[model samples]
Target: MTDCGCDKAKAELEEYLHNELCSTDAEDIREHLAGCVDCESELHVGRVLTEAVQRACRETAPGDLRDQVLLKIRTIQATH
Candidate 1:
């Protein structure tokens, strides 16, 4: 496992939050976080933001959005 100082740890923190890091990198970040208060706090913030974004992104579009989009596309194509 490589050593990650504060900068590298902070940079990869979002990946860590999503559990997307490889074992070596994850462990390095974990070890860094254990000893770093600022990074820990940043990790918490990252988690909150990531979860909020994920929730927002998972929402389905309005019921008629697809129909509306298709209608618009068809209209444009007909005009062309």
Candidate 2:
């Protein structure tokens, strides 16, 4: 949401969040995040989004539904 559209910063953020960044890049992002209010806000939003998705996923699929999926997989595997 910054004037630059924050593309470079957002890329860094995506990598940082996934723990896929190299040490130097991660440190640079960490420094930027500490000093830049805009990027910090973006990072906070990203964390909230990640947490919300995790919580939502936990609420999906009943035990019976999982059994049904496993049963279907077994049926297909048996055919092939």
Candidate 3:
């Protein structure tokens, strides 16, 4: 919907991090991030936050969290 393409880039940023986005889509976002300081800063923040959360999760080692989450997802999926 945005002509600047920032909107699409922002929308796909998380997926880009997770390797869920197609190569072409990721490439487009990369291009935008390269030229756009605003998007680049935002991407940097997202990366930092993602790393911090991952580090915290590694430190905490919540034993039942994964199972609980999967169960919840399955319950939701089944309901849908």
TM-score of each: 0.74, 0.64, 0.68
lDDT of 1 by residue, 1-80 (tens): 66698999999987898789998999999999998999999998988998899999999888799889989999999999
Which candidate wins on lDDT?
1
Better-scoring candidate (TM-score), 1 or 3: 1
| Model 3 C-alpha RMSD to native | 8.0
- Write the residue-wise lDDT of candidate 2 on 50-76 in tens digits: 889889988968889999999999999
Q: Alpha-carbon error at 74 in model 3, in Å?
A: 25
Model 1 ranges with Cα > 4 A deviation: 1-3
User: Residue 2 deviation, candidate 3, in Å?
Assistant: 13
lDDT of 1: 0.91
Q: Sorted on TM-score, highest at the top, how do the candidates line up? A: 1, 3, 2
The residue pairs found clashing in candidate 2 are: none
Specify the poorest-scoring 10-residue window by lDDT in model 2. 1-10
What C-alpha lDDT, on a 0 to 100 scale, does residue 1 get in candidate 1?
65
lDDT of 3 at 36: 92
lDDT scores in order: 0.91, 0.80, 0.82
Q: Indicate the TM-score of model 1.
A: 0.74
